[model samples]
Each structure stands twice: as C-alpha cells, then as structure tokens.
Target: MITDDKDFEAKSIIARMQRIDKWPLPPSFLAIIALGYFFTFYDVTDIGFAMPSIAPQFHLTGSESLFLALSIGLIGYVIGSFIIGYLADRYGRYPMLILTMILMALGSFGDAASVNLDMLIVFRFITGLGLGADLNLIPAYIGEFAPAEKRGHLAQITFFLGILGQAVTPFVALAIVPPFYYGWRVLFLIGGLIAVIAVVLRAELPRSPRWLIGHDQIKKADDVVSKFENYLKSNGETLPELKTDDINKINVQTETTRLSFLYLWQKPYRLRMLVFGLWWGLWYIGNYAFLGDAATILSDSGISLASSILFLAIGAIGYPIGAISSWAISDKFERKYIIFVGSILWLIGMLIFGSKANSIALIVGSFIASYSLAFLIGIAYMYTSESYPTRARTSGFAMGDGLGHIGGAIGALFLPLWVAEIGFFGGFAFIGITTLIAGIILVVGGSIATRQQLETISA
Candidate 1:
C-alpha cells in the first residue's frame, strides 16, 4: 500500500513524466509489439480449424479426448503465465517478452513435428507458458508507458493490430488444413516463424520505466523518461508544465521485493485481484466453451466444412472492428462500463446463434459475438493493468488470471457433455449467462479509473 514514506522528492521524474499527455516514442514502435501478439491469436485460433484434421489421425473420436486436447494448452497456459509473470516482475519486461516468443516458437514447431497426441500435448504446454506470460505482461507493459489520457486508446490500437491474427488465420487454415493429411503442421510452422521474427523486431522495444522505478533503478528510469522529453524538444514542441500542487499530490509508486508475489494478498490489492481474476477466468470460460468447438458444432448441425470456415472467417472481422470501437471509446469512459455493455451484446449474439442453425443467423450472430467478446477482452486488460502498482502488476495479473483459467479448462472439458444433454442452443446460452454474471461483477467491483494516471488510480 502507498504511504507518505513512498513519496519522491521535488523535481520527481515521475511527476514530470505524468505531465505529458502524448506518446513520447515513435508511432511505429508499437508495431512490433502488436506483431508479436499476432502469433498468440493465431496459435489460439488455428486450433479449431486444425482439430478436424487432427482428430482422425489422433483417434480423438470421443468427447473426452477431444475436450482434453482442447483444454491441455489452456492448462499449460495457466502454469506458464504464472511463472512468466513472476519472472517478468523480478527480471524485466523486454527480456521476458523475448523469452515468451522463444517459448512459443518452440511449442509451435514441436506441435508441427509431433508423432502422437501425447507429444502434441507436451509441446502445447510449452506454448501455453509463452501465451500466459505474453497476455499478463503486455497490458501492464503498455499501461506503464502510455500517457494516462491515451493509455486505453493506444492499447486498443495494439490489440486491433494483433487481433488481425484471428481475422486472417481462418483463410490461411482454409487453404492449408483440408487438402493434405499433414496440412495442419504448416499452420504451426507459420506461427513458429512469426515468433522467431518477433524476437528481432521486439528487441527494439524500450523497457518500462515504471518497472525500473519499482525496482529502485531510479537513474535508469529517469534516463528512459528523458528520451521522450528530449524527443519532444527536438520536435520544437514544448513539454507540458508540471504544477507544484500536482507534483505534491503525486507519490512515487514502488515496493522493494524479492520473489514476493505475497504483496498481492494485502487488503485492497487482494480485493482488486479477486474481481479482476474472476472476470478474466469467467470470460475465458465462455469463449473457450464455444470458440474451441464452434466449427465442429456448426458442422454437426449441418453446415458444410467449407461454409463453416467461411462463416467463421467473416465473423472474425468483428475482432478488429470491436477493437476499433474500444479504441474510440475506452479512454472516454470507465472501462468497466464498456465491459458491461459488451457482455450484454455478447449474450444477445450468442442467443441468436443458438436459437437456430440457419446460415444468416450463423453469419450475423458470430459477427456480433466476435466483436462483443473482444470488448470484454481488451477493455478488461486495460482495467486489470491499471489496478495494481508496478511491482506486482504482472505477477498479480498472472496469479489472478492464471487461476481463472481453471474455469476455461472446466468449460472446455464439460462443454461436449453439456452439449450432448441440451444441444448447441443450451450450451451457448449457458456461456452467455455466465458472461453476464462476470460483466456485472466487474462493473460493480472493479475500480473507476477513466482518465486517471496509473499512479493516482492505483494509489
């Protein structure tokens, strides 16, 4: 918790840093981060398409085996994320990001070469670790660097670019997965290649100055912040004046720790983590329940394989569109409110998809569900990242979201059985209902942080 002792001296670099409202870095720098994130979406999304081909070879005809395969990566994700988050907090964001890409590449390439389902599952665990770490650190990393006013806007843009992976991967899968027995392997190869490339690209990203401050590398932190200040001066743009009163109100946010995720258990941080964790876990439960089997469900319900891919591909357009919408509005309103609206919209869309098996309904409902679900995601990320101080942010998020992933695993595990009992309509409706509950919990329990500096809000 913050206290008077934690306050910085006059001429505080953080106070000076907070005075700027625009990004100090070059606009193009966000590209590589988004590019690295693209692989994550592709790896998660391509599984549904690849499963049809995979099942025949692996003999996963039973629902139990299918669901187990679907849920294993997520189980791995939980473990990997928590470990990586702690490491990132203790080490540094830039180094951890590179490590995450390496792990993902290893997992992807390993999956491509797997001789059996067991081999595939083992490799997938490796992949999940990378994914979990990426998801935890990226939002916190972004929030740490972003000007308070545009934090949400910049994150939404990065996600919008990253989300194109979901938008583009189906077409890639359509071309590869159906024509050959080993076509799915090619998809994995592509994901691996992207990860290798991201390593080189993301090497260019600067470390989070906030993270440096949290670790007591104050001189390094100032040097990093000074780059942005110097950049503004070079452009013939004056830096905003830091007021004495505003500076007095500002407290340097930090805590010294060694492998101490225990900091999260303290009072308001504990409560905040609970709310964010549940929201993260529950949202994934709904998405994994439907998304992992969406194509299969459609195929069984009489939609042709080709048509199912087409519908999914088209509907996937919603990911970027929804991201654009988030970019436009996330900075303007409290993020929890956006999450609430998204849940309602997702519920309506899921209902439409489950109501019947018609083509038009499939197209429209998937579109709505795609974008609305994206709403719960990126906005919730912003909310989660903003809730904690720099020292515990990534690890705290890791523990919270990692445990929440159990809900995802459970949803994927039981979904096939549940669908057998009540069918697709009932399955999707259940997801929608659970989503609504999570949304309500988030809005009621999460902090109100619109337009607030991360230090001020977390304090």
Candidate 2:
C-alpha cells in the first residue's frame, strides 16, 4: 500500500545527503554546536586547575580524596552519557543536547556554591553527566552532516575551538584563582553561565536528517534534506545524482528502527565497541595522567601554585597550534598513520616533561605534550566517530568516551600514589607506554574510514 511510501522518501533523503559535496548546513549552526564541544573539553581540565584551591577549602585529608576531587565528575560523565545517549538514540539529538547542557549549568553552578567536599563531589558528577552526553552526541551529529571527504576538516573546526577552551582554562585560573579567596568558585560559575548560553544556542541546532531517515521519519527527513538541497541549489552548486545502490543499503537498516545500546554487541558492532572502547580507555588513561595531574606534579616539584598555573599556561599555547595542524592534515592523510605519529610524539613530549622539574624543561616538555595530545584526540575522535552508524552512533560514542572516563579516573588516581616514589620521569613513562599501546591497537581494529560515505562505511 501507500503506507510504504515513507520508506521510499526516507531512502531518498539519505541519497540526497550522500550526493552533496560541501557541508549542507549553514556555517553559523555548526559554530553554535562547536561551543558545546568547547565547554565539554574545557571542563575536563577545569577541575584540575581548580584542585589546588579546592583541596584546602574542604580540608581534604589524603591523596585519594585529592585525586577524587579532581576525577569524581568522570563517574557522573559515565552515567550521563548512558542516559542521554540512549535518549538521543531513541528520541532525537536536539532535546538530549539541551538536557545535557542544562545538567552542566546546574552542575557548574552547584560546584561553585558547594561548601564541602561532599557537595562539590555531587555537583561535579552532575556536570560530568552533561559533558559526557554532550560530547557523545556532538561528533556523531557533526559526522552525519559533514561530507565524507570534508568530514575531518569540518569536525576539526569545532574541536579546534574546544582545544582552545582547555588551553584558556589555565590562564582563566591564573587570572581568577591567585587573586580572589573564592576565585575557584568564580571559575566554576563561569562554566555554569556559559552552559546556560549553550542551552539557548542548542535551540537553533537542527536534527540530523540522517537520524530521522534511519528511524523512518521519511517525510520530516525529506523536508530537512530538501531545504539543504534548495540551499545548495540557490548557491549555484550542482549536486551529483544518486545511484540506485546508494538508496538500497538503507532498506536493510530500516526494517526495524529498534536499535539500542545493547545491539552494539551484535556481529558487526561488537568488534567496533571493543576496539574503539579500548582505544578510548587507553587514550584517557595516558592523557588523564598528564592532564589531571600536571599541576599536582608541578606543585609537588617545589613550584608554587601560581607558578604551576603559569607554566601550564605557557604550554597551553600548543593546544591551539596542534588542533589547527590536525585540521590541515586530517583529510589529506590516512588517519591511522596520523594516530601512530601523534602517540610517538606524545611519548617523547612526556619524556621531555619528566626530564627535570625546572621551568625550561617543564615549558618545553609540556608544550610538546600539549600539542601532540591535541592532535591525537582530534584525529582519534573523528576516527572513532566514523566507525559507527546513525542508529547507534551516540550510544556507541557514549560507550567509548563516556565510560572511558573510568580509565582516565584510574590514570589520574595512579600518578599521585606513585609520583612521590618514582619521580616525574617514572610516572610519565607509564603514561607514555599506555598511550603507545592504544595507537598500535587502533591499527588492527574497527573501521578505518577515509573518503568514504558513512552509509557505505557502516555497512
């Protein structure tokens, strides 16, 4: 009957998407979504910078509590990703995106107002939930819209802004923390206020037509794609005609739109989850050891808190530089090679960082680490996002990066306990080794998508 016409239209919408050569959406829309990406990465290091100030305020008793103060939100991140990822997959990205941002605003504001360690832990967990979910959605959302060849370049534009947020945090802390009694509170308050702004911005973000098509919302999906087609046509661009095969692949995908997080364990998806999950865990374990504990290591090495912040700030310059570099290289090169090289450099940077506690070595080493890690993540995130399909992409991302916070938490906790005995070189060596393993594993597992349509790659 005519009831099946929706399926035909849904498939056509996807065909239109695959044919467009350039980004079909307005540039400003992507810019707004990029702000969400910025804040998510920003919060990753915000607590680490705030830790020195936070520790004394609550009279924290041990390294365990100290590291926990730094890493506790990760637990919230894991939980939030699961909740929002599922909701986004089942319902849609737009609503879940707003929910995630609201959680961050509440959590950030809550952390600022906290009077004790317990209250801070609670609020931080709330913030992590939003961060975990928002990050889980952002890449998948971007991946759906970006042309296959241009995917990496477009994604980097948002991630580049994000790295700058992380880089800017140290200076934000230096400006705020050293001067005011509750400068740390003000720093957190800033995260909350900006998150509120992001929530407002989310209202303008459109749902992925790809997502709608996958769920058989054909009329709506076609409506979105037609607008983009018209937009491109108005600009005098000629979109290529779609072959019949381009639309056929989606028919298999449409019989049941009941995909869930658990479905990731099925044949095609199981290996992806295992491989990408390990990569995320490994990446976080190493990166967290440095990012979560960089300030602590510096402070322990006889650098004053202000000086620790300053040195970190000096290295933060590399974050933006590396992000820009990745933007340039991501499309032209195979991502696997890029990942392998970034890790080797990341290890070298760690070695340099650990060579001495003095400013000369700290600044140089930190800059290298900062730069390489930025590139590593930018490339790796795109690589991982490319592995999954529209139906499960958000949850798949949540599974990889959200739960990867646990690995990060472990890395953050491990260094404080060991750094005192093995010294700086010893601690970083462990992280470097861990990072190298992740890059190697990446070569053998999951999808290695480059210049391929998402539908074809996922299939």
Candidate 3:
C-alpha cells in the first residue's frame, strides 16, 4: 500500500511539472477554430446558391424566396446572439461554443432532409441560432486565447474562412445542381456534413483559461493555462508570462455567475451597448445586402453560372486579401480608421456600380465594394472586441452583432423587391446609402468612445 501511494504521488508531481513548462499552440485548438468559422461562413453563403432552386420549389416570388431564406435566419440569430452572449459571460466561452455547434449540427441535419418549405424554414432558423452564437462568441473566444499582438491576425482567420466558404457555395451549386435532383438540398446536406465534422473537432478543443479565471474557477483555469503553456513550450514557442499586476488591471469582482442583458445597460456599459448596437445593425444591412444579392445581380448582366461562379470567387478573394492586409497594418493605426476607409470605399464602389449598370464597370465596382466590405467587417471585429472590458467582452460583441443582424434581415428581405423594381443599379444605390450613413455614424461614435475611455474596463 505504501509503494502504491508513493507511485501515485510521483505521478502527480510529474503532472504538475508538465503544467509549468510553456509550450506552443496546440494544433487541435487551431483546427477547432478553423472548422467552427468555416461552417459559420458556409451557412451564410449556402442560402444564396440555394435561392434559385428554392424559388421554384416553393413557388416563391423573387422577394418572397429571398425573404424566406434570410429573414428567418436573422430572427433566430438575433435571439441566439443575445442569449449565448449572456451565457458565455456567465458560464464560459468554451461551453457556449460547443453548445452552439451542437445546435448548428442538429439544425443542419434536420434541414438537409426537410420535406417542405415550412420545415426547411424551421431548420434554417435553428441553424441561424448557431450562427448567431458563433458571431457573438467565437471571436471573443479567440481573442481571449490569443497573444495580444497576434490577436488581430488570428481573429482575421475567421473572416478569411468565412469568405472562402461563401466562395465555395457558388462553385458547389454549379457543380452539383446539374446532377443532383435538388441542388439546394445538396447545400443543406453539405452544411450538415460540415457541422458534424466541426462538432467532433471542436469537442477536442481546450476551454479558454481566461474564461475560467473570469468565472473564478482559479484552480481549473490555472490548469488549463498551464497545459496551454506546456503545449507551446513543446512546440518551441515561449508562453506569455502572466504578471499579477497585469491581471489586476482587467480583474473585476463579480459573483462569477452568468451575466445578463441587464448588466450591459448599467453605467458606462450602456453607452457602449447603444453605440455597438447601432454599428452592428448598420453593418449588417450594408454587408448582407451586397452578399445575398451578388449572384442575382450578376445573373441579370447575362453572366452564366460558370462565369458568375468564377467572378464571385474572384470577388470573394477580396475579403481574405483585404483582411490579411488589414492585419499587417492593424497595430499601426486605430481599428476604427481602417473600418472608415473600407466603408468609404464601399460607398464609392456601390455608387459607381449602381450608376453604371449592365457594364463591366459595374462588375468591377461591385467586386471592389465586396472586398472593401470584408475589410470593414474584419476591422469591426477587432474594434468591437477591443471596445469592451474583458469581463463583459462576449456580451458586447453579441449585443452589437445581434443588433446588426436586425439590419441584415431588413436588407435581405427588402433588397430583392427593390432590385426587381429598380434594377441592380437602384438596389446597389440603396445599399450604398445605408453603408455610407453607417460609416458616418461609426466615425462619429468612435470619436465619442475614444474620448470616454471606457474601452478597457477594470472589473
């Protein structure tokens, strides 16, 4: 019995030693982040490709089809964002992420085999709930895990994959629609498959140590941090040294219980909530308006599915390219400035495209706008995440991003009707105005936020 006890003690000591040794980022964590973001993007783009096929199946008018595809998702997203955002703050980012993935996987599987428009709509709404959670929690989760300097680059990967997923949808539609009995159903099937894989991969990811610490699970949090550090050291990267002084800077005393929307409106947080909410709403309206309608608009220009798919790929490349470029310079300038420039460019491109309809110039203009919008959104993630105190980071992102989906729903539901009535030019012009106005508001709000110094809250 003594020998056995000695053996157990030795093992425990070795385990403790292993925890102290710093290590590089685990491949599992990176894979989980990638898979999670990839599906998020895939969900957003899938509806666009499915639109043509879905339109005929439901006997939906052009606008009705568009609304059916987008509005339901946005509604679910709005609810999910706020609910999960609050949950992440109260429970932990990791649990919330995993829960959402499960929700998304189930939603996708159900959607793939849905028999009617109503059932499909219900499943899509469920999928939107997952997407909403991702939009709210994933970036905040990534930000918490990443090194300060590397945060922008790592966070930008989510956007990069998002665009790639969007690009893949058009190609997928083109390839499968010809042979598949229902091309749109294939998109849902693909979504289900991706979600399954993502959920499996995500299950392997370690919970964020920061979240544990925030929740006052000190022993567990330290264990997680130690493991991450040891993993980094094994990979030849030194773990970041955490000084108690630095920890004190962001620490806030709380119940370590789950937070709610009510807390978001208290004191200084109220200002942030309002500002970010407006920003999100506007951003959504502007960005989705372009993305959801891109295929249809190009189709009107006599572009074949093949040409449209190729051009869409080319156009979508702008997102990653712009995001990467922004990352290179993100540390040099304030994030808000980058967003402003991108939005301004979006306005110019949209105006040029709308005014010069049915021409090569229009396509070029649209592509430029799409690229600029990606960069704008990339910057927005950085800005929004950075804008809040660490304790309420996920909540800030969720509430803001959730509110943005409201605008997105409006853009998605209405833009198609306007396009049918006024042509692509008019539709583009309308989005341009919305974006331009949003840009102005952000610029003004950012100034106010900077002056207020509420960005880095101390718990």
Selected candidate, larger TM-score, 1 vs 3: 1
lDDT of 3 by residue, 111-193 (tens): 77777778878988999888888877777776656655455666676667655675566567777753466877877788888
The best-first sequence of candidates by TM-score reads 2, 1, 3
Q: Which residue pairs clash in candidate 1? A: none
Model 3 clash tally?
Answer: 14
User: Whole-model Cα lDDT per candidate?
Assistant: 0.83, 0.83, 0.68
- Each candidate structure's TM-score, on Cα atoms with residue i matched to residue i, is 0.96, 0.96, 0.86
Q: Candidate 1 or 3, higher lDDT?
A: 1
Clashes of each: 0, 0, 14
TM-score of 1: 0.96
For residues 89-189, what per-residue lDDT tens digits would candidate 2 score against the true structure? Answer: 88888899899999999999999999998899889989988988888888788888888899988888988987888899889999998778899999999
CA lDDT, candidate 1, residue 396: 81
